[model samples]
Target: MKKIAILNGPNLDRLGKREPEIYGHTTLADLEASLRAEFAATTSLDFFQSNHEGALIDKIAALADAKFDGIVINGAALTHTSVALRDALAGAHLPTVEVHISNIYKREEFRHTSLTAPVSLAVISGLGLEGYFAAVRFLLKR
Candidate 1:
């Protein structure tokens, strides 16, 4: 099985609760369950979520050290501001996909920019929870 790490940052833990209007009703746990159920046969998924930038960066380093095949990350608000997180992802040298539940471009002007996108193999936006699945599929095929 291919080993993949799913890392969520910042307000993502508030998925189903924080902004039901935009992020939808899918909880973090629900997303994990759905991904696992869909990719169980071929993928070994490890999920991690953190509100702290350091913790998420640490997790990325750990995943790289452990030789994970790929990463699916939704850096939440960090996507716009965290240079350290972007560096961690680039430094990890693992195939990565950045996901956003809502269209960042459609939101605030600040959300339009992603510091992590250049390091990611792909960026999936406006797809809601399906972005995670698409990222995993792309990584798995690669």
Candidate 2:
């Protein structure tokens, strides 16, 4: 089975409550349960969520050290701001898929750019929670 890491950053812990209109009503736990149930037979998944940038970077480094097959990440607000996070992903050299619940293009101008997308194998945006499913599927297929 493929070993995959799902890393969520920043305000994503507020998934259901932060902006139901935008992120939908699925809590992070609910989403994880759904993914686990869907892919239980084919993949081993490890999940981590952190509001701190350094913690996230540390997790990425650990994933690299552990030889994870791929990564599915929803960098949340950090997608638009964190060069360090981008560098960590790039340096890790893992096959990564970046996911976004909201269409960054449809939001503020600052949200239009993603520092992490360039390092990811593909990006899923504007599809709400389905973006996470799509990202995991992409990594699995690879």
lDDT of each: 0.95, 0.93
Top of the candidates by TM-score = 1
TM-score of each: 0.98, 0.98
Query: Distance from true position, residue 68, model 2, in Å?
Result: 0.3
- Candidate 1: C-alpha RMSD to true structure equals 0.6
lDDT (Cα, tens digit) per residue for candidate 1, span 1-142: 8999999999888989996999998899999999999999999999999999999999999999999999999999999999999999999999999999999989999999999999999999999999999999999999
Candidate 1 backbone collisions, by pair: none
Model 2 spans with C-alpha error above 4 angstroms: none
